[model samples]
Target: MVTAAIGGERPVRDIVPGDHLCLTFADDAEQRPVVTEYLSAGLSRGERVLCFVDRTTPGIVLDWLASTGVDTGAALLGGRLRLVPAADSYLASGRFDAAAMVGTVRREVDASLAEGFSGLRICGEMSWAVRESVGTAELARYEREVDAVFAGRPVSAVCQYDARLFGPDQLEVLDGCHRGSVEPPPLRGHDSLRLVPAGRAGRRRLRVIGTVDDRTHDHFVAALDAVLHRPGDVVLDLSALDFIDVAGLRALANAAARLGGHRRMRLAHPAPVLCEVVRLLGWDRTPGLVLLPEGDVA
Candidate 1:
């Protein structure tokens, strides 16, 4: 984003790298421009960027990047970003091999370093769950690893932790490394069902929006059965869903089928991952899904 204020042409994607990261934003928005610019600049320096985002709405950060037309793949090492799924998903990890969320990011960092990605970016998005997980030891270790990664190569780790979620010390670490802060607009998610519609339309609109691990897949399946039982009119509002495991998705599919004769149930709010999963499993015909604004998909 170019600004007359900065008097410079800058890509929001490449603004900061090495301890002296500088992201220039308008006099209006507080710290966001600085934060994203730092991420871009850090990536330009060949340092993989790690963003600690609010897990609840982590997609917002990425969505913002897309809006800014930033090459996030270059900014992130995997060409795809990583996030710690919901806190509950992590809690369920013990029962599943590939399901358990990374308990401590330090271990994940160590493993990644050992694997030698040259440049790696890990973002623990801001969320209530992430804040609880960021204990003293975990926070300290994470910082140490960031320093270690930099020492090994010109690595620039950037995590956009929620100011509300983190304590002084945690913020200190991100800021200590000179990682700029980017605050998202207020979260846009329904906290709870204000009034679950029992009508046919309500039933069909409730989209299945979560992933399930092996152990929980059955549980998820069981719960979906109840939703399935709620008559054919219910809809699953999945628009905000981030991740739903294969088995989990399968369970939802089964739910849809079970209600096929009785009612027409469908999914809504499909993130990219959701679409991929739907296609991979050959369940692409959206039954009761809702489309984002027309211009969103392209």
Candidate 2:
């Protein structure tokens, strides 16, 4: 049940074992950063990483990792990183089989653990599924089955999808099979604010950095709206938020109230002023609005 913001390395870096993430990109320009960061993070954390390559060669993928300052040679030499060809793995036997693929992943995870690695991290380029031998329904089924394998296991996976190759309908179907999608780009406000989605302990979070006042109120609300659409309780990580006016605080309270049944909007580590306003206005008692103590935001 791990999830992440639509975009950014921070979110990807936060990915823990047992999380299955879907990443969609338009081209190599958009894909390189995310893929490299994900692999680098795993390697840094002592995890054995396996990257299944399609639409590119192993050499090229290695180069991409090297360019990101990764010690590619050392990682490969230590048996901590493997760049596999998709054809020899995912599409082996000349076609895709969901059960076989799931078993393959399970075996990989077990092998990594046996080898004394912290855990297993996988990144699969899924463009090969577009071949004639592969069926859309089978692709979706494989993703769903893989998700089951990842749950509560010492394995984390990211399925990379090329938006230019897959149609919107097919992409939507596949995206729904994973815990969450990693968007290609981050959402930016007009130089005043940035809202990034993140997850921790299976809870969805929106990291709000920068100010939230009259000028940036609309942007903040829009970002909040987008995050609210996600299933489960939402945590607004205002740890880095510089300032927030009363209007912004009210919006959070209102949103929490709207989410009435079991779902809550948690304001994590909000500024002192914001807390005072909530107490002064008696919004602290609002049913779904929770104000977390300073050190508890993370």
Candidate 3:
């Protein structure tokens, strides 16, 4: 199995050969280190690394890698690293063809394995799409095709998008397409949340982080609802979650009531705050909901 690190830590072992990851980063400076770390990790594990550079030129990227103490020269010389222009990758034949790009990606994966690499790791800078008028519909179709191409292949991909360039609607489409997303580290003592998509099965697993209050209620609801739409059970791992406001609590109750009978929801490793809220609301008896103790968390 292939594993990719989210936010420099949090190794997600659930990543299989055909998994596609979506990444939204603040800027090239903030994302360079993370990307370097990811590529470096793959190289260490004997995986072929393919990087598509758009906003950042090859020289700049190579310099960043060198700064990270990675032997970019040796990696290139060894045929373990393949760096190409992002526009070239996305605009093959002077047009963006989702089917063609997906086929090319699959071929690359197969070629990598045939060349003696254990697997293939791909990171594409998606800024080209934004500048080239790649419509939301087109990009979404491309993402879905990429996901399909990954199935049962020794290929792991991270498609990068700029948070500043893409609007919320486009970003949401991007997020919904990938199996998982790479999140940055949480603030030291601030309130925040991170959702990590588990797998492609009907079941969806999310790892919640930090606090959930009125400030984050909308996002919390959106995240929860996103998972509920999946085929089977929805598992919310709340072990790292610190707090939940009344609104957040109501969101959970609403989800439980809405999913009653038709679907199931699992609350794993509920913190003290969550446990108390559920108890106070008598949500322990909520239908179609299961609360697993910390030790029994799935």
Compare the candidates by lDDT and give the number of the best one: 2
- TM-score of each model, in listed order: 0.35, 0.61, 0.60
Would you list the C-alpha lDDT of every candidate in the order shown? 0.43, 0.77, 0.72
- Alpha carbon lDDT at 232, candidate 1: 29
Instruction: Give the C-alpha miss distance for residue 213 in model 2, angstroms.
Output: 20
**Evaluated with TM-score, which candidate comes out highest?**
2
Query: What digit string (tens of lDDT, one per residue) describes model 1 on residues 181-290?
Result: 33222211233211121111011133333344654455555545544443224455565454567776666666666565445554545567767767877776645432
Q: Compute the lDDT for candidate 2.
A: 0.77
Candidate 1 vs 3: which has more TM-score: 3
Model 1, residue 22: what's the lDDT? Answer: 22
Which residue runs does candidate 3 get wrong by more than 4 Å?
2-16, 187-298
Clash list (residue pairs), candidate 2: 6-183
Q: How close to the true structure is residue 169 of candidate 2, measured as C-alpha lDDT?
A: 66
lDDT of 3 at 18: 67
RMSD of each: 18.6, 11.1, 10.7
Model 2 alpha-carbon miss at residue 20, Å:
0.5
- Model 2: per-residue Cα lDDT over 56-123, one tens digit each: 67888899888888889999998999988887898777777789989998888888888888778899
Q: Give the lDDT of residue 41 in candidate 1.
A: 50
| Candidate 3, poorest ten consecutive residues by summed lDDT | 4-13
User: Which consecutive 10 residues in model 1 have the weakest lDDT in total?
Assistant: 195-204
List runs of model 2 lying over 4 Å from the truth.
Answer: 1-10, 187-298
